[model samples]
Target: MLRYQVVESFLSINGEGKRAGQLAVFLRFAGCNLKCSYCDTMWANQPDVAYTWMTKEEIYEIVRQSGAKNVTITGGEPLLQKGMKELLAFLAEDESLTIEIETNGSVDLTPYLSISDRVVMTMDYKLPGSGMEDRMNLSNLKKLRTVDTVKFVSGSREDLIRAVQIMEEYTLRGRCACYLSPVFGRIEPVEMVEFMKERQLTGVNLQIQMHKVIWDPEMKGV
Candidate 1:
């Protein structure tokens, strides 16, 4: 009888991270713990937003219908949902499916550790531009593995400085794959690349939001 507050679920090519251009089923959960300045999905956190309350079986059926081998569970902070453990547990049954969750890195990841081997956590380390960087649970960085990814959405040169500091502090490159992406239309990818080159920053990749390029930047759902 457990149900998840789902804002929307659709099949789309992953627009970011290491999986960019990969077809996957995305489940956008409702609600969030922080309000970032550039959040495109603020509507997902609004109390009055329209959403479907779906049970595990219902969610599984949707994924089955998508016929995608990869599933991305994103949010307004998916960890805020009560039934995520159950939903993840259900999804884990499909050994052939690769499940990934995108979190704001402010929530405790321990709850999902049991299935760590099966689930990949794309933890976004919020930067100064987000205005919610203080809320980041630094300990979560220790939970990462090579299978997971840690990302920084840089909105300015200052933000990349913070990312570099953290990257060195945690030796994140050796811990897991680290990615640096310019905030859509705010910071340019070329600028980030130059910065990395000048500093001889190693082990961090420059990524772009491929979905925004393939479709109208303003378009939602693939």
Candidate 2:
């Protein structure tokens, strides 16, 4: 049986991405390859973290019962898990669902691209503040489509500047949904807006984690 190390699963509004503010089923998987300085889900990334082993059928049933059309497969770093493509393929069988895979910048996305037309990607572009910038797979940027998203979680002005440079270099604005999100308390939204205006970074959206605002920042399971 194919099983996944699931840290948590819940129904909630997508706090980020193009589907932000819309209700979605979140499947948070366990483990990650890189440690970001601003990672809020560090508790779920620990080597010995408590997790439930779930088959793809079990996971699909949870989403089916949630009555949500949008599904977000997030993680400490979702792509690191084995059988991820198979799991995604299973989920994709439900044509009515919109599956969004949230991946840290390190992993290669090419392997999962053919899984389904309904599967979209929300990849991160870790900045210097994350301390995992060098681990980013730059090639993944080219793979993003208009339906996909590239999120830049900025903690400092330097990070914001680097984000703009990368966006320009990759011509990301027209290629996909580019988002600049503040690292919770590190940088303010107004500050990010100002930076965007100053740089004339047109077409990029500034997103705030709505779940953190609706509930406690540390709260789990929505």
Candidate 3:
């Protein structure tokens, strides 16, 4: 009875964040609570976007067929789905599988706390460039553990400054893995690295979108 709206499910390397370059099965869900200007997956954000309804068992079957031990449950915002907690609980039973939940950091994560050990929450903390920073659930930052990551997408020097401020304010680096990634085409990855070095911001990593570099930036379903 619990069916989820799915935009697509395919095998692809994680393009960004800490899991970049890892082969994983991506389960892209439909719908989101916030809209960002530079969202690459805008197709999945539309309220009327056509999607297939799949239950947790159906999704798990696809993952099993993919032959990938790792799975990333991503979306326009996965937490918005009513049965996401149930889906995650089902996936967590596979002790050999590594699951990652890519969230927009605007929804409550408390429901998934019990399975935190099995699922890594790669939370995106929207900056000014995204226009959705105000919508971020800052409380989620406190819930992160070493296995999880808090990411900040910077498009300009000002964005980087704000990210650093939030990092210190939250003591994020000490709390969990912190990453600073540049918004593609807006800020150069080297620029972000230089800024991090100048600030001597230890424990924070600078990452680029690896999948974009490996394939055409516009290609889908890789």
Candidate 4:
């Protein structure tokens, strides 16, 4: 049986991207390659990752338990798991489920492209302040489609500058749906809007954590 760090499994609203507030089953896998300063899921960082190893049949039972029509494979970095392909292949048997993955954009995601017709990939594009900018593969940005959304968590005006530069260089503002999110309570959403207006950026949206409003900002799940 393949081992996987099943960090957390629960039902909740997506809270981000184009599908905000949609009910879904979130399978937060454990382990990450990038150590971004503002990572909300930093509790996943460990000296030795811990996980619940399960066979594909066992995995199906868990999703079957969730009673959710949508499923999101998130991480510490779900792509880090080699068995992720197997998981997706198994899940694809459920014809009614809409599967999506939230990736940090540091990995080659080609293998996952075939899993679902509605794979809403949400890419977290690390900025200068995230301390992992160099790890980003520029080619992936070009491959990202309109169905995919890119999220940028801005911590400062300098971070915004770097984000805008990357957007322009790749024509990201026009190519796909882009999201500008202020680190919760750090940068102001109003400030983000003004900056976007000043730059005349198109396809850029301001995203807020919707679950934060319904539940406590510190609350883990619904």
How much lDDT does candidate 2 score?
Answer: 0.92
Question: Is candidate 3 or 4 superior in lDDT?
Answer: 3
Among residues 3 or more apart in sequence or in different chains, the pairs in candidate 2 whose N, CA or C atoms overlap within 3 Å are none
How do these models rank on lDDT, best leading?
A: 2, 1, 3, 4
Q: Tens-digit lDDT track for model 3 on 82-165?
A: 979889989888887889999999997888877748788999999999999999999998888888899998899999999999
Model 3: lDDT equals: 0.88
Pairs clashing within candidate 3: none
lDDT of 2 at 112: 86
Pairs that clash in candidate 1: none
Model 2, residue 98: distance off in Å is: 0.4
Q: Which 10-residue span in candidate 1 carries the lowest summed lDDT?
A: 110-119
lDDT of residue 1 for candidate 2: 78
Q: Candidate 2 residues 65-126, lDDT tens each?
A: 99999999998998888899999998999999999999997899998888776899999999
> Which candidate number would show the highest TM-score if scored against the true structure?
2
Clash count for each candidate, listed in order shown: 0, 0, 0, 0
Q: TM-scores for all candidates?
A: 0.97, 0.98, 0.97, 0.92
Candidates ranked, most accurate by TM-score first:
2, 1, 3, 4
lDDT value for model 4: 0.81
Candidate 4 TM-score over all chains jointly = 0.92
The candidate 2 region of ten consecutive residues with least summed lDDT is 111-120
Per-residue lDDT over 1-222 for candidate 1, one digit per residue giving the tens place of the 0 to 100 score? 788888899999999877888999999999999999888888789989889999999999999999998999998999899978888988999998889999999999988978747788899999999999999999998888888899999999999999999998888987898999888889888899999998788878888888888888777777
Cα RMSD, each candidate: 1.0, 0.9, 1.0, 1.8
